[model samples]
Target chain A: MESDRSHRASRRRFLGGVGAAVALLGSGRRAGAATPDPAITELPDWTRYLGEGVASRPYGRPSEFEAHVVRRNVAWLTASPESSVNFTPLHDLDGTITPNGLCFERHHSGVAEVDPAKHRLMVHGLVERPRVFTVADLKRFPGRANRVYFMECAANSGMEWRGAQLNGCQFTHGMVHNVMYTGVPLKAVLEACGLGPNASWLLAEGADAAAMTRSVPLAKALDDCLLAWAMNGEALRPEQGYPLRLVVPGWEGNMWIKWLRRIEVGDRPWHHREETAKYTDLMADGRARRFTFIMDAKSVVTNPSPQAPLVHKGTNLLSGLAWSGRGRVKRVDVTLDGGRNWRHARLDGPVLPLSLTRFYFPFNWNGRELLIQSRVIDETGYVQPTKQALRQVRGTSSIYHNNGIQTWHVHAGGETENVEIS
Target chain B: MSRFLSLAPALLVLVGVLALALPALGQTRGLGRPALPEEIKAWDIDLRPDGHGVPPGQGSVKEGEAIFLKQCAACHGEFGEGAGRWPVVAGRESLVNENPEKTVGSYWPHVTTVFDYVRRTMPFGNAQSLTDGEVYALTAFLLHMNDLVKEDFVLASDTIAAVALPNAGGFYDDDRETTEKHFWGTEPCMKNCKAEVTILNRARALDVTPDDKGAPKVE
Candidate 1:
């Protein structure tokens, strides 16, 4: 008890010292020569006292200092919040795997808070035997596998189709997240029900208010698809569809139906609203492209972006993320002077197929302006195209699948801004 | 002869065990029960483009206009022009323009999509609240507003597919493999790709992005 009182007294003294330093700095006086650095000289309150016990936070959360690291949404992007999207804070995150709570959310209606006890998944239509499995029943099934994959919304950089629109990377290229999913193979589940010989496509439906539906090819479902119930070693978050969700590997994120409730095998594709009216890409020649599922190779520099600008003058680390739907990212090329010159970035961690790969480039910054960019080459040997190259082929009419290289112009004063370089 | 006869019983036991395990391995683990027909019917609300799963109902444009004014007019404008940021459902603007207005009449390839999407999820919040007859009416009214149907025209499951949208021929299957694959070269440029880099556009100048203070308050 005596130690606790002394700790409180020391904290008060520390806070008072901080206030005095702030006042001295605010008065435009040079306090560095007159007073020593308190951060190094004086002991902090955290060091003097014992921290909280393990039981304090039953589950756990990021540090209070990291409260700013959160999912953010552009308010005017959609009509209502229920049917809108919130972006992942890529600039603030490190490593390849995204935290469960910080994953971007794109919902048609709203996040459905489903009760695991009452939730049921129905497999019907052209199957030999239509079956219904509850959440508990799904868990008991055999052949559960864990796999890491990246889910990128088809519209990750859609707003930039016209040009550089949003300032921050969070808004520009943040509609993606990488996570380890634990679930049963969709093929095993389909084989259990016995698929019909003529079944070609299957409609995966969600239980949200929108009843989101998308037709997925049967071939894709049989290979690499999963009925995932957990992500990042924990139960799926409510926004990510609790209890169960469909994981369509290497495909557009929209097809990964959340709050998954039904799978109906059919002979042909169901041209649902999502496939036709929305996800379809419109061309400048008055034509549209349907069933464009695969998200091509893309990369973006997270640090030194608009949100996280360069702050130091020397010995800084440039970090970014690269991913491809086709396969593993073979290499990531970084350019400090726009696209005039490029260098191979070092892939730091695990490089798995259909997963985000973290890369870093250490360089010395001498307070000069820079036009930074990164490009990715997937295992398929397909190189990421420039924005102009993409616009020439796709035109400015597309709202999805804009995997063009992004440029960040850093000012001499260490602030960065989103810009398009010619 | 005595040794051979003694081993026959052990071989028979092993064969019997194999026979029992093979069938179990071939079949499914058998975890869930068969879905009853009634349960399937309750949840099977999706509709295809060929009018396969559409329910039997009929509604006229006049009936749909009344339902739209009351339930949908608050968001979707009275004349289907759209209220606020809601989608405009009546426009037939040209797609080959700087800012094309992709409405039901301009971009939707098939009329069945109108009926299927409306029947499955419509009116935004109160989805699946509309009856089959109301859905048919609402679809007919939207078609009338888009000038695809006369004011007195009636819409039903049998006739829905015949009402072809104007952009029916404007859509094609994804051909990116041929159209855009050539752009992705085997070896990307490494040095001096551009003689000089010039800034063409800046996001800060547009200033349309939502600021930090205006973070979404979605529940």
Candidate 2:
């Protein structure tokens, strides 16, 4: 009886509030009619006219006001736009999946506009029977699979290894994107070539001006790699290797050659320019580490970062992205007092192996200073290391695969800046 | 008929599964036509470290210099010292120790990479346009600029493999699987993981980080 009475009382109170609001609006309109009215109470011009109807915008687009949400490139990072990278707008995005358009782009030469009709995939060298596959031929293969995976440049947070260099997470950690790929397993296609005993390596080459190529261990080629033609249920954008691209899960983005055209099976690694001269990690001891494929577990708090700072003091949702090339992210811990104390963050979305995962932690701020950070632990039980810990081994020279912890110093005035805590 | 034939295998497998009988191995489904010998030769441009696929060509250092100036000098500099932020193709003899300057001369293991990379992607705008002889000439020019070969040297397919890099022995296979094996531990410390912590540095101190134009307005 008491519960019913309380429910009735709440309904009556809500109705009373609505009645009072209507009365106030009526009185204000009547009073305004007597004076020179300045408010926008009259029907607008848009309401007076019939707007453009169905099929007006057959293809949808974001509102004109949201023009700022775009992939950005740093002017001084490279000599020209052709050989540079554009960072994804991670600060403007929520959830795990990155839209196909907003995904980061890294090109060695320039984006190739390939004609699918003319494009052909040649599988030759060290095979029982070499085969040539047109686009239609590739589509006819069985065991077509769709999977969501994250692709990260080995140099994602490389600049911050020396110190907290980039201000925003978009620049520091935005060289990564997660998307659902519709593709055929590379193993299935390689099987058609009839692998020989000496075929230990597979060289994937692109058709762009660069003709960018990388050698993959035959074991990895036959494991979980893919020849993807579509991303997020749409044909790949021209910038993203239109007809096809190699999707080597859990490996550096360079190995995932785009605009894929050929695959040559060989007995040994090619040790090409990308693997030797570029992607190799330089150590303090003067020795460089080559073929370091796996990207370790890493995480960064996207919000409460330099780009997305706290606007008000009260309830704030601390959200970020955590991922690992090895497997699914098992746990993410957020620290408020630097590294002294940490709280287990709630995993927000589906946690798939080798895919980006979102995590969130809600907290009420009293407008005090805070040093925010996040640490990720993957399925392999590998904990994300501190910047100091990584530097002890790498010594600040190794550029690629710097999965160190990131810190954001949040001030009492609702501003945050990238900082390093030792 | 083709659809029915494909479905017959699945139906047989289903019946075999219910009867606990081992299903017959399916035949390899061949879809595409056999690759022609000319098609294979056309796309097989990769040159291995052991000098397997180097085409029959000869290029002199004198001829290479002219090609370098015409084709590669814009990005790589006339003397291979590099222009602006492009790769410094020459010099940096002993700098890999202290503050490393990893140029082609100081680093890079095999010389086959130079030949393959130049032929596959060079002149920046127009790739795969260089003739085999021109690629040999460019390789010889880079070798001369690196102080490894004399000015009169002619680089050919047979002579390329013997030319070793200075830092050929300076590399090692990835040992992270063993070196960083200790990093994996299931139970990580949560509260009071460290006794004390201090802010050692800020990214803004160096004035390097880009301006946060997208920062939310502070109240």
Candidate 3:
């Protein structure tokens, strides 16, 4: 409601103030790329400190050299950008930290360009004391937590349900990313509202044009849900909900509403469209499956993936990422020449609960056309299966939960293409 | 020496090109100038559920009806029945699990969310253009159409705090904490995982749709 011009100016200044310490001249533009003009003298200090500043970017971003890290959409999937999804570039880097800018995106009515200044998080359901927290007030709450978790869309591997639909990891396992969240625990804030004894469920709604809404179990909300204020150590980027978003670890990403503000606790799940019409899985029994909240374990190889081609016939360090919505990835097994032989991979980085776990497979290549694949084992003992293994059970008619082993065909020329074994 | 001298111009140009190309090739860090005082004062309009940052204003159902008809009815429909694929504004309750028809009246958990949504993004094209009074009025009218409120029931910045949403009781705060039960090595058993666990027949547990619609779902 505070629409003063000064307020808008202040927002601009905050961005301008982001530590652009190592301006590095043309760093604002693409790296190693030529700047249009060469005749200009020295630039200003602010401009000199152009790129993200030191200690400023508490959470680091991908190097400018890795500009290809992005979310890509399958044009054949849907027509509109607002109604469809674009996956993250899962094959581009090492480590579990997903840069805020490179995280994958799925939109209902498109990302709502909601202004944090006008946004408000309302909690007014089955509560004894109803209260609204200003962005500052929410920050003032006592409980704060820093946790790492991988957010996988329920539809991350949806393509493999039928067959290998896409070749690149960007399209295969790109619908998910892991990041560190900084925020107040949902319980701490809910307690301030004084929940009624009957409050057993929570309906989360977004401030987007779609007004995306979903019903979450009260047990889950008070369990691990975080009203996240920061991603990867920095205030969220606008695309990732600049002010705040709901972070539900180890669950489907859709339930993690961005630009979040409302939490109404009740005794029953509000069968919103997301749970009933859209997100639900249609079973072979002609019954529309619903309440499929948890996202299962899944993994894939990023490097030596489609876009990352083999430069030569030598020893290459092949690595990929594995994660589980149930818990930590137990181990990742890699097959260099198809499943004829399987070898264990080294799982690295912070192997936190329900977060992305990076796995590496060191192999010697002899320049022959080979079939490469990786399988993940979760703490729940769930093993990611092959595309054929998956479709044999759950027919290809589902669009929701698809956790299958993905295969990449490597050629003598070192080019990888998406393929099926059986 | 003469070759180096003759190629100096081009060499300098090449160095500049590399400098332009690799922006981070040579860089040092330092905090630049301080931001102006005005920068910190923005974004103070965030509204909390416990009632903070709410502006002053009030509107009646009669005043809001016109606003709704002119601004909302086009997309929401003349009677707010939600004519097309657009979401239905009212009617829905007990329709969730079994043959459910989700609607604002039946499924929305909190009425405050209606106001929160409108104030944040509404009317599709011209979002955030409505006055606080108009927002209150439209909120009341939408509820009225859902049969939750009387035809004359009015909503205002002050009165909105009291309207309880039907779906409000359908939600809860998430709080999952410990992960040791699900993660962490049990006995550092890196070798022979097969000995520790016996494999029974593996049955398919889930079936996901790969395409859009009418595809046969088998599991």
Query: What DockQ results do all the predictions give, each relative to the true complex?
Result: 0.44, 0.36, 0.03
Q: Among these predicted structures, which one has the highest DockQ?
A: 1
Give the C-alpha lDDT of model 1: 0.86
- Give the per-residue lDDT digits (tens) of candidate 1, residues A1-422: 33335434533432343344334323543444577767779999999999999999998999997887889776566777888898999999999999999999999888999999889999999999899998777788768999999999998888888787776788889999999999998998898899998999999999999899999999999999999999999999999989899999999999999999999999999888898878888887978999999999999999978777776667899999999999999999999998899999999899999999999999999989999999999988889998999988878877889999999998876667789999
- Candidate 3, residue A238: lDDT: 70
Look at candidate 1 and tell me the lDDT of residue A21.
Answer: 33
True contacts kept of 3: 0.00
Please report, as a residue range, the 10-residue window in candidate 1 chain A with the lowest summed lDDT.
Answer: A13-22
User: Taking the true A–B contacts (Cα pairs closer than 8 Å), what share appears in each candidate?
Assistant: 0.73, 0.65, 0.00
Q: Across residues B1-219, which tens digit of lDDT does each residue of candidate 2 receive?
A: 999998998999898895563223222255667789998888889898888888999899999999999988898888887676566688856634543556668888888999999999988998889999999999999989998899999999889988898888877888886887777885777889888778888865644422222111000
Decide which is better by lDDT, 1 or 3.
1
Model 3: per-residue lDDT, tens digit, A8-79? 453333223222211322244343457554435557675767765588778666667666556666543543
Q: Which is the winner by DockQ between candidate 2 and candidate 3?
A: 2
> i-RMS values of the candidates, in order?
8.0, 11.3, 14.1
